[model samples]
Target: MAGIQDGMTVMVGGFLGTGTPEILIDALVEKGVKHLTVIANDGGLPASVTGTTDRGVAKLLSAGMIDHIIASHVGMNPIIGKGMNDGTLKCTLVPQGSLAEKIRAAGAGLGGVLTPTGVGTIIADGKETLTIEGKEYLLELPLHADYALCRASICDKFGNFSCYKATKNFNHVMAMAADTVILGAEKVVEIGEVDVDTFTTAGVYVNYIVGGEQPWQI
Candidate 1:
């Protein structure tokens, strides 16, 4: 929380709107954090379609708080298209599977990942390529963030977390790939309340935890 400065790169954990940490994002918007570079799966759904004022990264995008984004898709959010066309925001789109592997490589402390997902396409334009056994693979660099904001279905006092259903999509990986990890949990329980067997993210990776709001509120 203390080190969130201007132009910081942030990784937000979510698939569409399901797993985004809405509470932390709201706080960031309230603080007027600007010129951010966000990394996520998709741009986010619009308020009109979701029947809400803001959801996922759209909150920051709508507030003009973000300057650039590296995501796999943006078609669902008109704001992204408008910004890109108007030159207000910059976007770099990646193959979805490659995106996930890049984040995972960062978290795992690997130099990079090799995949065929982007071979022979524009995605490989400026990237390195390697041939192994007569097959080609594009080298995608790891994607790390200065901070990561994630949502958890449940979090304990010590910050151990478990997500419900599809909410776990990227939260667990993003938690390990950032310098600072913050979580917003729907339910905050005592340290021992969350079973270790069920925990997807350990407290050692988390820096802070905040109470989360319901889906409607987000």
Candidate 2:
């Protein structure tokens, strides 16, 4: 949190608002950092759905903190659509599978990946293509961020992270795709309390931890 500055690339872990790290997000809002390029699963719930307190990435959008977002889905938030129309924001929509693979490639230190997900469609526009055995594939590059904001249902002092149920979606993959990862854990347990097999994200990837976040709310 100390090193966060305006105009950095940030990856947030969430599906809509369900698995988002509220504490860290709220802090970012209070920090008033702007010109952020965020990468997430989708645009989060709007104020209409979540009432006065915007949920997940929507909070940042509401605060006009995000300048560009690279996500697979943006239809859920009107702010994103309106911004896209008004030229106030930039949105890069990649196919979900291809997006995940790109992040994975960055984390794994790979150059790039070839995928047919966007072949023969508008998604293939202005992109490199390769023909392998008469089938076309787009060469999707890796995605990396300056900081990744992640949430975990449980985290040990050493930073092993585990999520509860569906909340586990993007947090695991996002943990490894950034230069620094900030973890917000609902509960912080003793080092031996959580079994290693239960960890969704290993401790090595986490650089910072904010413990004792309130439990999930509707």
What digit string (tens of lDDT, one per residue) describes model 1 on residues 36-144?
9999998777787688666889888999989999999999999999999999999999998998889999999999999989899999998999999999999999999
lDDT of 2 by residue, 103-196 (tens): 8888889988999999999998988999999998999999999999999999988899888988876888889899999999998888888577
TM-score of each: 0.96, 0.95
lDDT of 2 at 8: 98
| Candidate 1 regions with alpha-carbon error over 4 angstroms | none
Report, for every candidate in turn, its global Cα lDDT versus the true structure.
0.89, 0.89
On the 0 to 100 scale, the lDDT of residue 34 in model 1 is 87
The true-versus-predicted C-alpha distance at residue 210 of model 2, in Å, is: 0.7
Off by over 4 Å in 2: none
Candidate 1 is scored at a TM of 0.96
